[model samples]
Target: MAENKTQATGASVDEFLAAVEDSVRHRDGLRLLALMREITGKEPEMWGPTIVGFGRYHYKYESGREGDAAAVGFSPRKASLSLYGLMYGPEAAELLPRLGKHKTGAGCLYVNRLEDVDQAVLAELIKAGYRHVTTALHSP
Candidate 1:
């Protein structure tokens, strides 16, 4: 099996956020850091190079592939913020419509700007996702 490339790293979250060239993305990254920290009650860690993740989960598939992943995470990409683990399960299906402007790709939720979405809804999504991944999908 191919190993997961995006393993947890010892990278500095603060340094990474500070190095974000775009002023808007830098600010949004900080807000996301605070929001995710408050929601998960877990300090953020760098997953690979770009993703700022909270908590952790281990997953194993029927096909025998297994790996550890962040319970929830986001990357402040140049074009948009790529939110991971927030678009899974029924809660996400329900809350997405009310989350204001956003786009979805695979398991990711993409928002161009924080002002474009309802932060309350985003918080709900993060809470739900964090709960689902940690409790439901996490391997024993």
Candidate 2:
């Protein structure tokens, strides 16, 4: 099986966010860093090169592939801010409509800017995702 390429790394999250070329992205990154930390009660860590992840979960596929993934995280890409773990939230369907302008993939939520969405709604979504992913292991 191919190993997960985006495994957590020891790189400094501060250094990575500081290096973001876009000022808007840098600011948003900082906001997300603090927000995720407060939500997950876990300090941020670098996942691969760009993802700022908090907390973690281990998973094993039916095919026997297994890996660890962030319970919650986000990346401030040039095109948009990519939110991970939100897709895992049960409230995603209802929340997305209230999230303002955005897009979603199988496991990602993309936003052009922080102002484009309702921050309170975003917070609820983040909390829902974090709760779902972190507690999935204990659910029967």
lDDT of 2 by residue, 93-127 (tens): 88889989999887799999999999999999989
The global C-alpha lDDT for each of the candidates, from Candidate 1 onward, is 0.93, 0.90
lDDT assessment of candidate 2: 0.90
Worst 10 residues of 2 by lDDT: 131-140
Model 1's alpha-carbon lDDT is: 0.93
Candidate 2: list runs displaced more than 4 Å. 138-140
Report residue 114 deviation for candidate 1 (angstroms): 0.6
Question: Top TM-score: which candidate number?
Answer: 1
Candidate 2 root-mean-square deviation in Å:
1.9
Misplaced by over 4 Å in model 1 are none
Clashes of 1: 0
